[model samples]
Target chain A: MADKVLMKGNQAIAEAAVQANCEFYAGYPITPQNEIPEYMSKRMYDLGRVFIQSESELAAINMVFGASAAGARAMTSSSSPGISLKQEGISYIAAAELPCVIVNMVRGGPGLGNISGAQSDYFQSTRGGGHGDYRLIVLAPSSVQEAYDLTMNAFDLADIYRNPVMILGDGYLGQMIEPLELKEYKKPANLPAKDWALTGCKGRKPHVVKTLYLIPPELLIKHNIHLQEKYGRIKKEFCLYEEAETKDAELIIVAYGIAARVCKGAVLKARKEGIKVGLLRPITLWPFPEKIISDLADKAKRFLVVEMSMGQMVDDVRLAVNGKKPVEFFGNAGGWMPSSDMILDKIKELKL
Target chain B: MAAIGTAEIVHAVNRGENLTFIFVNNAVYGMTGGQMAPTTMLGQKTTTTPYGRETKEAGYPLRVSEMLATLDGACYIERCAVNNAANVIKTKKAIKKAFQNQIDKKGFSIVEVLSQCPTNWGVTPIKSNEYIEKEMMKIFPLGVLKDKGN
Candidate 1:
């Protein structure tokens, strides 16, 4: 077994990315996520890899777009407000069908609220955070270990699906240190090369990889449907989640990221008190573990979704439950982290 | 080959090294329906600037070559108008120098070419060439704005 070293979530993500041989990284410095680019600056330069401290979030994502199209595993990282600026280039990355990884170590915000972890970006990360009809493989990491593991998975998933993959971590997760095994994971055998890359052709016809479908409505329609089909394949193959006491629990606490960790402790405490409370931690927030919740709703009495936002994922839980079970939400915003005690209080209040 | 956003070029060069840039400045947004560009001439009338770009409302034309020349990282920066054969020869030389600087690992180099947009300018090809000589040069002077080591 590989020995584990204590590491921050942000630094773990950077280490995992380099281990995965993602040779290009372009990013601007932002709060709570600065360690990512800072770590990359050193490691990438030591190995003679391409690393550009891009002008802004806009330039950073575009540089990622250029590098990914040029057949390099490339990425960028930012926090909440910065990610808003990246939405345009992210949309272009999707429209061009370029594979890359993006990380958002989220902070509290409608706009630059504070430099602390918050899960309000759930809607933005899971929903189409950019213009145009597209989807990102949004992976939410609950701890430093998952941060490292998912960062590697994100690269493979992006290349396998020919789509962007986002590793959504919060500020608390980025700053906290935990023991993580830096293992050399194997690449999936079925993953292939980027044959559609914009590498210059020497003996063959020059290839053009662009998103401009000006004429012929059917052409754009075909492209849109093709992307949807790819997303469908991803949904079928990559619906990931973790379960605890879901089989016989009366109330299942739905959460993800750090929010889920707090919920887990509360679930344990509630179970010791003879209450049948458990957790459903979603690993992939996009291909959202819908069937599991739907199936659990058939047997569970209720759901209590605790989050760090004003009740966003509660909507998804409600949709999954679909009136079969009562759904309730308790959240804290603007960097006010919810504690296990708060979640346990909510559990006691639910009395399911 | 087309003109890019000003910030995109300026910041990329300002932050990076060993890069080459060829900036095509036609004094207008040429292909995108003749709108105003950051390099649009002071009094030029375009689709957006119908009132000839009032100074109080719209700022003066941005001299991107001169602007980027101030940075220490910019190893070379030159502007040349290709309106005639003599200027075309000079533009070619400037273009070669910029690429050579990158090959020599001489930091960032940019060559801004003063091009003519005949259709967008609403003039004949000959008149458009003359326009660069008569109008564009007054605002955007043709010279080596900066060279770290001439």
Candidate 2:
């Protein structure tokens, strides 16, 4: 029998991490997401797991990088400003193909914006916040259950892809409490001994895991091509989305994360008023359900892109639709969350 | 003999098994253009500061050693200087103590090596050392803020 308990989103994620056999957690405390590190500090300390209250976000992510490189299931989390600070290290993690989970309980952005729920980091997460031709397996969780489940899945996806996976949540999602059936904790499989870990050579060959390939232009290009191939494979196999009331719908709303939750309410209310509204929530924002959106574009006359950021995901919607349907965007930025009523009004205004 | 500061401190901390941190309180950035750092002195001047740093305009430089002292992980925290050979020896002792603390797995340790940034001070290194001995020491008194005593 699954153990059901009421837990805050942040606590759920922390618990899920422990269940997933994450042995190392290094992070600095930030608002709207402090519960994660705080919980980890107490729980992990009791469990004799390594937890470091890192000096800075830079230090925290790098510590995670080190632990993950050493073949430990490691995680670090932060809000917007801290996540911005971690971009450089995140890029390093991706380049080295190290598996690690990064949770961004996103707040307002562009600067030290605010401690409010915002999806402004959609582009930052999916498009690779740092400089690179790489993509993180970005998972957007819309509910507290997902906050727990996705965090567990994040470790698996990260290990499977050997790429960084982000559990993108908003401040509201982080703060909200919900009932969750906790999954059984499974010990991670023994990782094949890799030469690259910093463990003592112990009479084995020395290993180097570095992204600096300054030898030749052709060699660097070939490495990039190989990474691209991996990304291509991920795009095909890992793309996921949830469709709500798509059959016989004229207007399809495309949203993700908390915004999707709001859109669902709006869609339901609009349905009661005789508006044929449906929702398409992209679960994996990077391997964005482009094919699904393209197929919907054929039947849906109008598409509305809703987000907490000002139309960041709209670009992707436009690309997916490819002018097959009229795409409209509505959003609130810098920590402002649009209410379900406002979203309903927008859908009504679009008059599909 | 050689001296080190934040750059050397971070490098050593990252590389060495048991390490210490030494911070200098010259009240200036002391590097490219001497603007201000987290530890810039309250009233100091540099190329960027035509007038002395106004308390209202620019905030005071933080005592980094004291900050590190508060961390539960940190073991020993002390502030010392190299204004004179006697004080330099004292600073050396503090650095050794910090390293010893870490070697004992006591915790993270730091030693503030309050020295002078003469180039940014617009003075000779000798004059800067003298200024540090006379002025800076008065503001940032040297002592062990935290000691795990391991």
Candidate 3:
């Protein structure tokens, strides 16, 4: 039987990564997400996993990138500001198509915004936050259990896609505690023959994985096109979302991560008030649930988008709605969280 | 020691090794109270050239990523601004890419992060970011210069 345990979202993610056989963890401590590295430092050391408190977020991410490229399951976690210090490495991993898991316990931002919860990074997480024509499989976990499950699955998806996977949550989710079930652990298969990885070439012909194409512009274009195809395939196959009361909902609430949790409460309140509101929570943020939103547009008359940031995800929702329904945005920036009553007021004001 | 030139970059790429180069472009020797660096922007005021960096006197801010991207071995090269929130996000992406490039064993990667030296710039952290945005980004626009395998 699966054992139930109460754990903070950050701790659950750390444990889940360990159970997934992640042997390498490199990161700098940052607010809300500090518990993750703090827990991993003690646990991974005992487990003989390589855990390093890096000099900076830059060094930590690079270390994890190096280990992961060597076919090791590796991970790193940081807050919004620290995560900003890591985009260079993230873009490189995306370009090289290496498998690694990165967690961003987002905080308020737009400088040193605040140490509070905010989803302002929605655009950065889903829309190739890093440079180049690359994409990360961004997963948004709404609960502690989901945080654990999504982190475990993030490694698998990174391997499956041969790309970096981002577990994007906010300070709320990172700091919150909830009941969780420790899932059975399994080791990743011997990394599929990756000739590109750097493992001191001994027997095999030396392999080089690089983004530099000193070749003709034509060649670079071809490489970019190839990456686009891969992204298209991912969009087709990896769009994960949950629909709550969407079937009979006249008003669909689209939210993600911690915002989704708040939306749930709002939905419940709205239901009691006789408002037919539903919830569309995105589990996979990158290959966003555009199709579901589009489908919902056909059935629902209104869509309300909520987030901790100042209307970042609202643009995506508008694109999905395509003017079929009125898509309204309700948000607070700089770590401010919307209460259930506040969201309910928005729903009432919108008359959705 | 490896000579600092194009040859070093080429050699690293041919061998498929990861290298990180942190280029501090303060336009002037910031530690020495704002003297000009090789990457100092033209017409910019530095302690060394308080009259403002004249085109003839200070030359131009070396667009490091642009030159580095020309190398075959460089996998990821980007210029980032570290002074503010919007720029901070861009800078973090650049940093992550540089590290990821090294780990992926995809040749050499470099991040030229524009940082503020309040003491040298004769300003506060707030004004430093403003100076970077208003003055620095004009010369070194933030973006990825080279992305081959990514």
Write out the backbone clash pairs for model 2.
B21-B111, B22-B111, B23-B112, B23-B113
Residue-by-residue lDDT tens digits, candidate 1, A1-352: 8878989999999999998889999876677887787677668767878766554678889999999999999989999989988999999999999999999999999986888899999899888699889999999999899999999999999998889999999999999999999888789998888898888999878877798998888999999999999889888888899999888999999999999998999999988999998799999999999999999998889888888999888888898889998898899798979889988898998766
List model 3's recovered fraction of native interface contacts, to 2 decimals. 0.00
Candidate 2 stretches with Cα past 4 Å from truth are A186-196, B1-150
From the highest lDDT down, the ranking of the candidates is 1, 2, 3
Instruction: Write down the RMSD of all candidates, one decimal each.
Output: 16.9, 14.6, 15.8
Winner on lDDT (1 vs 3) = 1
Chain A alone, TM-score for each of the models?
A: 0.99, 0.96, 0.96
Query: lDDT of all the models against the reference?
Result: 0.86, 0.81, 0.81
| Candidates, DockQ | 0.02, 0.03, 0.02
Model 1's CAPRI class? incorrect
Q: Write the per-residue lDDT of candidate 2 for residues A194-313, one digit (tens) a residue.
A: 446767767887667788888778877887899899999999888889999988889999999988998999999999999999999999898889999999999999999998988898
Ranking of predictions according to TM-score: 1, 2, 3
Give candidate 2's TM-score. Answer: 0.72
Cα distance off (Å), candidate 3, residue A112 = 0.9
- The residue-level lDDT of candidate 3 at A37 comes to 71
Question: Which candidate leads in DockQ?
Answer: 2
- Poorest stretch of ten by lDDT in candidate 1 chain B: B1-10
